[model samples]
Target: MSAALALRQAIHDRLAADAPLAALAGAVRIHDVPPADVAFPFVILGEAVVADWSTATEGGTEQSLTLHAFSRAGGRREAFALAAAIQEALHDAPLALAGHRLANLRATTAEVRREGDGRTYHALVRFRAVTEPL
Candidate 1:
């Protein structure tokens, strides 16, 4: 699957699994999958960690998360929520999707694909955010 598609699925799984998602949704901002590295500020067990995007496919698409995530039990809700919200915002970003922002959004399943040495994954979805629409 395309990185964008995988991204969409990853975001959905993360959001659906996260309980704090309602609060973290405000900080999400998705961007285009560039050839360069991208970092995500993820919180684990109440601590903040940066998830990096480094692995890309031969098609010039990246699925590997550049940010390193430590192993932690529970609190997945917070992490998933944060990741989903950010992805949604980036996928719908104007600079990335451009004229196809609204059209590019997939309300159905998310895009997910496994790549690399069985250690990395990538998604094609991107989104931007601004807290909740309050």
Candidate 2:
């Protein structure tokens, strides 16, 4: 598999297997493509961008991953809490990527805001990672 795909799979598996995260977001609430009738206060594996980070002797890749947390609570607290949990789960995590080595993973940024609908709160958490072929 491509480095980006491997990284994404590893991340999803890690998040899905985290007990603390599941407690906060509920079981199976983390999704690549959320169902049409999905509930609020869930997480979505959002966009990903990949670029070459190759050297003369080795092949590598840099990836930017974005995960979204949605909540319809009375305030932003729920969304922010979910974002924090996600960051804690992934920041510097020792994820084993398929056919690649995870060089580093860090939570880069997190933005929480109320959506235009005015009732939904959205938290966008971004992560930066580097991977080298094994």
Candidate 3:
């Protein structure tokens, strides 16, 4: 698998399997997009951008992985809590890439805000990943 895809898969799998995340978001509703009528607390894999980093004898890539968390709690609390767990789970945590080696992975930034609708809270967390062919 390509490094970019592998990185994303790693993040998704880590979040889906985390005990903390599961405890927070019971039933572990992580997906590409939550159903319009589905539960409030859930996570989604959002935008991603990957750049080529190829050398004469090696192939590599740099990627920006974005994830979104949504909650209906009174404030941006639940969302922020989940973001913390995600960062702890992924930042510098060794991940097995399908066909690449992760050189480094780290949390770049995370932010939470209340939507204009004023009921839903959204948290966006982004990570940077560097990988090389295995």
Q: Higher-lDDT candidate among 1 and 2?
A: 2
- The model with the greater TM-score, 1 or 2, is 2
- What's the TM-score of each model vs. the native? 0.25, 0.95, 0.92
- What lDDT is obtained when candidate 3 is compared to the true structure? 0.86
Query: Quick one: best TM-score, which candidate?
Result: 2
Poorest stretch of ten by lDDT in candidate 2:
22-31
- For all candidates in order, the CA lDDT equals 0.33, 0.91, 0.86
Candidate 1 per-residue lDDT, tens place, 64-105, comes to 222212112233443443445544533433322211122232
TM-score of 1: 0.25
**Backbone clashes in model 2, listed as residue pairs:** none
The list of candidate 2 runs beyond 4 A from truth reads none
Candidate with best lDDT = 2
Task: Estimate, for each residue in 4-101, the C-alpha lDDT of model 2 and write its tens digit.
Answer: 88988998899889888888877648788889998988888899899999999999999999999999988999899899999999999999999999
